[model samples]
Each structure stands twice: as C-alpha cells, then as structure tokens.
Target: MRLEKKVIIVTGSCTGIGKAIAKRCVAEGGRVVIHGLEPELGQEVVQELGPANAVLHIEDLATEGVAERLVAVAVKAFGRLDAVVNNAALVLSSNLHTTDLTFFRRMLDVNTLAPFALIKAALPQLKQNRGCVLNIGSVNGWSGEPDLMAYSVSKGALMTLTRNLGDTLHREDGVRVNQINPGWVITENEARRKHEQGLAEDWYKDVPPVFAPSGRILWPAEIAAAAVYWLADESGPISGQIVDLEQYPFIGRNPPKN
Candidate 1:
C-alpha cells in the first residue's frame, strides 16, 4: 500500500498505460480521478475501480478551463490531492513536411501545454499537501524518429517542462516532479492503431527483437510499477529526473541489418 489514502488524478486513464496506472494506484489503496475524451471508456474504468475508489472526468485538453476543472473534480471527490499523472497526449505520426502549423500546435497543446496547465491548476493544492507530479514522456523526446517530428518536439518540450518545474517547485514549495520516457509499449490503443494501419492482430507478438530487446515490447503494468515508486513517499523527495524506460541504449545506434 505505497499510496495508502492518497488521492490522485490520472488523465487519459480510460485506456492504455494511464488505465493501468489508475488501477494500480487504487489497488495500492489510493483513490483516483480518471480523465479521458471518451465518456464510455471513462465510465468503464470508474466502474472497474468501483465508486469508492474512483471517479471520472471527460475532458479534451484542447478546450479551455478543463485543466482547472480536472483538478477541482479530483479534490471535490477525494477531499485532497496527493499526486497527478499527466499521461494524456496525442501520439500522431507526422514527418517534417507533413507537419503543418495546425498539426504541430495540436500536438503541443495536448502533449505539452496541457501538462503545464494541469500543474499550474494543481499547484496550490499540491503545495498544501506536499504532493508530486508524474509526466509520461516518451523516448521520442530525444532525437526521435524522422516520422514523428511534431510529436517528438512536443515530448521534448514536456521533458524540459518536467525539469524546469521539478527544480523550481521542489526548491520553493516541496512539490516534487519527475518524468518517465518509455520505449515501445503494447497497449490496447497501440494494437488498434496497428490494425488500422493494416497490421495483423498478432503484430505485437511478432515484433522483431531489435525493437523489442526482451523478445516483447513493454506492458502498461511495467510502467505503472515505476510510476508508483515516483508517486509514493518511498522516492524520498527526489525531483527533476527524466527516466528513460527502455531495454536498449538509444544513443549512437547502428542502422538495422539488411
């Protein structure tokens, strides 16, 4: 029960890694407020966690006032906020030429700006409770794939945001912030995206070892485990870290074999 009695807000929690984090948080004795764009999916997670442990908030981060509203809902439901996981993001594919101004803005708004708004909205409460923040960044934050230009830029901004706030807030208000940049993860959304992109249903199972060094890509639960450690008191006041959760070192890689 690392998070016993803690109250947390997890955006994009209707599915995928966010869903796993919400479930894990509750299982460890914390209450959660789940957020997503899909009402049906959000309700499902709320029901899964039960009324006693979870609530739902349907939000589009592109909309104004939603960030403040999300924080309010969490505090209203649980009486206090102990942590927030900024896990919602737009993971669309776009190369340099394909990334128009509108597309780039949308990516930044969802992946980077939304987290900034959320942390700002939750700051006062976090200060009061000495709470923490967890940003779900991506390995793309580094150099990134050529196909993921705008998305990569957004994540890079988010990484910088994590470091900037982590340093400032912890020094001033005792609020800790950290980020996790996970490699390829197999989620329901990812599988569906693969199917939509003409891949077979078992595409995940057949991933090449070069991409999945452990013979498989990561699962949502694995990321959740590390998230819990950062959110819990056991992490002991450390802040401003961007942890890359990958099996292989991403730097100076050789091109794939023919």
Candidate 2:
C-alpha cells in the first residue's frame, strides 16, 4: 500500500505499459484515471480496476483542453492528485526521407508537447499535494535507429523537458520530476507491430542477443515494479534524473561479432 489513498493519472493506459502501471497503482491502493483513445478499451480497463479504483477518459492527448480535463477528472473523482505518469506516445517508423513536416509535428505534439501541457495543467494540484511526475521515455532518445527519426526526435525533446523541469520544479515547487528510458519491451502493441512488419508470430522469442541480453525482452510488469519506487514517497527528493531500464549499458556497448 505504498500509494494508499493517493490519486494518479496514467495516460495511454488502455493498453501496453500504461495499462500495466494503472493496474499496479490500483494494486498499491492508489486511485487512477485511465486515459486512452479507445473507448471500449478504456472502459475495459476501468472495469478491471473497478469503478472505485479507476475512471476512464478517452481522448487524444494532442487535443486542446484534454490535459485539463484529465486533471479535472482526477481531482473530481479522487479529490487530489499525487502523481502523474506521462506514458502516452505515438510510435511510428520514419526516416529522413519518409518523415515530413506534418509527421514530425504530430510526433512532437503527442510525445513531447502533450506531456508538457499536461504537466502545466496539473501543476497547481501537484503543487498543493507536493506530488511528482514520471515521464516514460525510450532508449531511442539517445541516438535512435535510422527508421525512427521523428519518433527519436520527439523522445529526445522529451528527455530535455524532463531534465529541465525536473530541476526547476523540484527546487521551486518541491515537485520531483524524473524519466525512465525503457529498452525493448514485449507489449501487445509490440507483438502486433512486429507481425505487421512481417515477423513471425513468435518473433519475440527469437530476439537477438544484442536486443535481449537476458534471453528475452522486458515485461510491462517489470517496468511497473520499478515505477512504484519513483511514485512512492520512498524516492525522497530525487529529481532531474533519467534512468535507462535496459539489460545492458545503452550509451556504449560493443557486442561480440559472432
């Protein structure tokens, strides 16, 4: 019951990592506002977490006023907000040649700008409660693959936002801000993405050593487990940090050429 009676807002929570975090928040005795684009999926998550523990909001993060609405939902339902997990992202494959201005803008809108907007919208409540923020970034933000140019750029901007606000917000408002860059995680969307890319059904099981050093990629539950510490009071005044959650050192690691 680390988060007992606390209220949290988890975006993109209808599925994937966000869903896992929402569930974990409930398991730890916290209330959550589950947000996503799909109404059916959002309703399902609300049902799973139960009406008392969770509420559902279906909308695009890029939409104006949606962030405020989300905050309103949390405050109206649970009375106060303790934490916010910015996990909603638009993951698309685009290279220098394929990424147009609109594509890049959309990427930034959802991945970077939306998080900033939400943070700003929730600032008052967070300040009142002395709550924290957790931004879910990706290891791709470091350099990224060739085909992930726009996505990578968006994440890179988010990393900078996390660092900038983490320091200023923590010092000024006593609200901590931190980010976690997750490696390859086997989520439902990832599985479908691989299949859509022409990989076989069991593609995750045969991942290369360079990608899955532990013989398998990460699990959503594992990320959620690590997330609890940051969200809980146990973290204690730490801010302006980016922790990469990968099996190996992401910055510089030369794998054996077998």
Best by TM-score: 2
Write one digit per residue (lDDT tens) for candidate 1, span 63-157.
Answer: 99998999899888889998999999998889988889999989999999999999999999999999999999999899789888998899999
lDDT of 1: 0.93
Per-prediction TM-score: 0.97, 0.99
> What lDDT does each candidate get?
0.93, 0.94
What 10-residue stretch in candidate 2 is worst by lDDT? 249-258
Could you tell me the TM-score of candidate 2? Answer: 0.99
State candidate 1's TM-score. Answer: 0.97
Clash pairs, candidate 1, are: none
